[model samples]
Target: MTHTTRTNRGLLRGALTLAGLGLTLTGCTGTGDPAHPITLVVRDAALREIGADCAGATPYNYVHAGTELRFLTAEGTLADSHTLSPGVAVAADDRDYGEATRVPSLCRFTVDGSALTAGTTYTLSFGDRKSQDFTYQPGETAEADPVIALPPLGDPTTEDTD
Candidate 1:
């Protein structure tokens, strides 16, 4: 091979070797538990106005029950009745929230039928690692928008005679 071609080949091999080594080192470094399942409950008041847009509006509240649950790694079904990615974050944008937003107030969650209790806190365990607890209480009702009121029509008794 020509001298220039041989030198270029050597440099390429060295660069590839360094890249492989870097990837291997990064793989060995742990980033803590990769999966933690969390659970959130929708309060009755919040349920009434779930379609309303308001500040601090959360479709559901994460309940903090001081208990851990097993995180399921498999993808599950969503409210739209469709399957989702295993670790996908189900946010408001994924559902029909009336507006475009990145708020995580809405997420794809499985309701644990066995863990539900009235007037109690709960927590969600995600993928067997990360978990968060939240207190759930009835949310306030959102007022209707006055600007969107319907136009007044003429009284039925005033209809014109043919």
Candidate 2:
């Protein structure tokens, strides 16, 4: 075959290969829904349930309320943040994610050109506090529930122990 014809065939093969690669990358499992976005239900140490309306959670409220709840990738990339009551508001990465007719946005990531699956572990950060890295399952609640509480303010040190 002529050089030009051979080059065209080579390009076609390359394009097909790339297309397959893209499909494979997109075909992995993912954290679903932005509105029903995965939650990090924050409860006191007693699991008393702290919502966006926690009274004592002030100061730590603003930043701690909406500012907390950051979803970081296993590679520590900040994938998303959830900021509604119950905080940690993460929707899938879609522009219309918040709308009622939500497109299923699975929580997936690409690290170093590798597709990370949905059940892939992700870090949950509340302000400076971080929970153990974890993977999420669809329709899972306890996985999202975190018994997050701040240290008692101005408590005495060890010497004060009596």
Candidate 3:
């Protein structure tokens, strides 16, 4: 073949190779919805203030009626908001933490899977407290629920020892 013809054929082959590479990368990242639901847990030691009544109590860390759980995108845009009911007493042994094993309750909530996009990072925030950034892997769910342990409310050393 002529030199010009040979050069054109080489360029075509390179273009095809690049196209195939792009397809392979896309497949690995997954193009479909997540396989499992996204759940987030917001834990705070302040729940112990609800008193020893686990069955009947609604305690707030501050003066607010309830805590606001807000989900934000990587770009810092608000995605959605959920209400975290006032504290309900829970067994300390059930959610015992290191050293201070007197914690009372754990706050839990689930996010709608349809609202989340695969391979995207998100942030869970409660009031001014923010959880670590997490991402839902492509084609699958997060390995575990994102548990945000909020800082203790008021004094940590002043526990009711009665």
Candidate 4:
């Protein structure tokens, strides 16, 4: 073959090799199943001060592709879980406030299993972990708050006493 034809063939072979490598890499990185459902938990001091109408003030919104679950505060409780379909926003509103307020700390968790799935439980306790408190106002949109960072798992000083 002529020099120009030979060079063209070599370039085409290199391009095909590169394309095949890219496809292999993409297949290896395919999206896997979610390990757990997204769990959001909020604690607000204002909810306790207010009465039943505002009982649902402290709320948690859990969402996945096709499932949207909500956990709102029940009377004297932190969360009351509810399962819902996709593309819906569940909220509890008793009154309207002019602006948004912040809660000191909000926690996000990844919980395995579904409402029907067995052998699953929720936990937020940590060694020497102190519960942080915050305030909330009416009509404010709920969002995740900063998490209080803790030391490493093996730290003796941080271990639970009881």
Model 3 C-alpha lDDT per residue in residues 121-161, reported as the tens digit of each score: 77867676775566655332243422232322222245332
Query: Arrange candidates by TM-score, highest first: which order?
Result: 3, 2, 1, 4
What residue pairs clash in candidate 4, if any at all? none
lDDT over C-alpha atoms for residue 11 of model 2: 43
* Residue range 24-79, candidate 1, lDDT tens digits: 33331111211211222121122223222322124222221222333222242211
Clash total of candidate 3: 0
Go through the candidates in order and give each one's C-alpha lDDT: 0.26, 0.35, 0.41, 0.26
Model 1 alpha-carbon miss at residue 113, Å: 4.2
Q: Summarize candidate 4's per-residue lDDT along 114-145 as a digit string, tens digits.
A: 33222222232222222222221211111121
RMSD (Cα, Å) of model 2:
22.8
Compare candidates 1 and 3 on lDDT and give the better one.
3
Q: Pairing residues by index, what is the TM-score of model 4?
A: 0.20
Best by lDDT: 3
Q: What is the lDDT of residue 128 in candidate 4?
A: 23
In candidate 2, stretches whose alpha carbon ends up further than 4 angstroms from where it belongs are: 1-34, 45-52, 55-63, 84-117, 140-162
The list of candidate 3 runs beyond 4 A from truth reads: 1-42, 45-65, 87-89, 92-105, 109-113, 128-131, 137-162
TM, every model: 0.21, 0.35, 0.38, 0.20
60-141, model 2: which lDDT tens digit per residue? 4433334545668977898766543323221222234343443321111211112224556667666677755655444344
Question: Cα-based RMSD of the predictions, in order?
Answer: 26.5, 22.8, 22.4, 25.4
Candidate 4: lDDT of 30?
16
